[model samples]
Target: MTGDVGRAIGFAVVGALALLAPLLEGRVDDRVAAVGTVAPFVVVAAVAYLSTSGPLFELFARPGDREEGRLYGLASFSLGIAGLAVIYVAFEFPVSAFLVAVFALTVGNLGQELTARYTPDPAVGTSAFAVLGTIGAVCAMLLAGVLGASVPALPLAVFVAASGALLGALIRSVLFVRDDSLVVLSVGLVVWFFLELGLAPTLRRVGIGIALTAALGYVAYGLGTASVTGMLTGVLLALFTVVLGGFGWFVLLVTFFGLGGLASKYRYDEKLDRGIAQENEGARGGGNVLANSAVALVAVVAFAVSGHVGVPSAVFRFAFAGAVAAALADTFSSEFGGLFDTPRLITTLRPVAPGTDGAVTWQGVVAGLVGSAIIGGLSGVFFGLNAPGVLLVVFAGVVGMTVDSLLGATLEGDYLGNQGVNLLATLSAGLVAGLAALWL
Candidate 1:
């Protein structure tokens, strides 16, 4: 077999063994089971060390840097063994966790190899890294949980620091084909340390949520529903909500995005035929997402931080609800209004084209109200808002939507853009909600 084919088969065999090791736990003799458990790690370490001289080296190393590549490869291999030893001796991770770690390492290395070999498509390479990073994160979380149970904080911290350092070093070598180990090591340690402290219980959920959100965003970009920058912006927004507000907030955000996306696509061809469709054919950009969500993200951050300062959490809760409600309202109004034949300008109240700036129609107005009410109702249910609180959110949404139109009529496409208008509207809604919360 060719060298590449031989290496591929070897990696595949190691992965299969790692996966099956856990299943063979009780069935085999004690010594044999122990050997099985350690076999994968040995294979991995050997591959990491020997790969520098093999086809795998060509994948990760630039043509002119073979010597540096060998040094980094040896360092990575040594660190991998050291990390496994720490897990085995210090944390005493179970065979299951070891198997998971082995599987993660295998998958990550495979992804790295594939990404390095395929240089034609940058998106594919990015996607591969994203997938592998996500898998590694999940596996790390699982291993951390297993080791953290009944352990003191100090040991947990040590474990996290060590794992981060090793992984960061390996990643640097793979990505840069050089040894910038300390830089990435410090970054990884700080990031993982904070993650452990802030999101200990929800690490797995956060990992899975982020991974799925990234996948969805990529799909949206691929489908021309959103730009690449928009997809990245959405991913950050989703990550913040998932980390700060938990699953409920994530759900609320997803609901609004899904509904708004569907509405944008409704009668798309008809809108295009009439020359009234959205610019870029409704493909949103980073500016669009941030305009609608920046205020909400600020609220989430404020809410998260308020727990330490004895501030009432309701303030930020209402602010978040109002911001999201305004975003939904604006989206529904703009998208559905374009379907009306004789819309009227918000400022002059005279007949205007369906998609004219500041245009409004009865059907569009009702749709906007319904959309806002949906978010308001969900906030009430999710955040324990009273009747008056819900009403205040809905009121704020309506006011914000009106403000958007007023701004669009005068400033949009003149001194301001669509993103600027959306930003001001959402900010106004958040401010309104905050003020209302003081009274209610």
Candidate 2:
């Protein structure tokens, strides 16, 4: 208990000390500001290398505190350095905004640790931490700005606080299951993304993303379609589509989600009896949600950042459609393919069990193609994709599913996880379609 409080205080102190670089934001060049943000972490990392088993490691966080006995503090220093560089150099945010953003993220992280340690209920603890952290961050940011930190617009301040609270809560929920440093870095990047969102779209669109995501997430939770973490995780992914990629992309994702969910629910009893059902009665968890959508998120972000014109616009549009199409094709292949009794391995063409990895059936192949066409046709309507673009999207989806089966047959069970295969398949589909559009 005491350790938790001590760690919280340590975070607060370190976060404050880290602000010295940002204070140089206006006084120096942006590149220099970026370099300055990295310098402190470099020094800390050296000291950490020299004294891994010593006092500072134990003070912030030690190995075995999170996952696989990893040193989260060292992880934080390394990731933080890289993340701050992107924020300072790539984004070129003003000093005040950078200071406030980092302050909110750091405080939100520490607050979660402290609250979770002392509070009995995990849900209650995290919620309280989010609320209290928001208050602390807002007040402190205002005070800092007033005291020569930097001037901040009221709306920007609010955006920073909301991003911290919402993204912090979502990230904190996963910390108990994995390493904290990556989670910390994720929060930083997410907050950065959320902050940048303010510049691109209207506040009304942002609100629409938040409101609709919350509503759908709550409905999914109430309908027992997803576990708590799954729903929360989906909310963030949905926001990325809606807020960054626009309505067309968001609707395509919804189509994939709806179809995939229906397919999972199809023949549930038979799959369970055969010992091939999705885990937890098809209720999605964080891993399941991330596996299907991470590549889509990347595509959406690329589209959002590319200014939505010319070949790049066409490329990302194809990329987004291909990713969704691939995801749906894979889902259809898995859920529909399992219905057949004898399946042939994609690599060997030998008979395998109904649910065997790399197993493909004639029924599954047709279903997968149909799934891809549905998305491809929708892409034509939504993204203004012409005939060639639509065909390319469908072809890319088929290729992605084939790649998925190939990987599953070869490496999935022994060397790679199922989720990793899914991510790779979507990535490949996006790359193929995007590059094709780029070249021809």
Query: Which candidate's TM-score is highest?
Result: 2
Instruction: State the lDDT of candidate 1 residue by residue for 1-440, as single tens digits.
Output: 43333443454354444434444445678567566555655655565656556556654334433765553433443345335434443443443334334433444445655665746454454445445644553454445455432222332333333233224423443354333323233333344334434434344655565665666677767766665556656666776677667667776676677677668878899989877776677777667878889999888877777767666788888888888899999889888877879788899999987677788888888888988899889988888788988898888888889899989888999888888999999999999998688666
Best candidate according to lDDT: 2
Local distance difference test scores for all models: 0.63, 0.72
- In candidate 1, how many Å is residue 95 off? 29
Candidate no. 1 TM-score: 0.62
Tens-digit lDDT track for model 2 on 1-440? 56766766766666665566546556788668667776666666555445545466667564354343345565565456456645555765444444544565567657766777766755455555555656666776676665565544554555455556656667667665224344545555655555665445566766676677767666666665666677666776786688777878888887887678778878899989877788878777778878888888888877766763444677888888998899999899888888888799999899987778889998999999999999999999989889999999999899899999999999998998999999899989989999999998
Q: Worst ten-residue run, lDDT, model 2?
A: 62-71
Reference-based lDDT, residue 31, model 2: 68
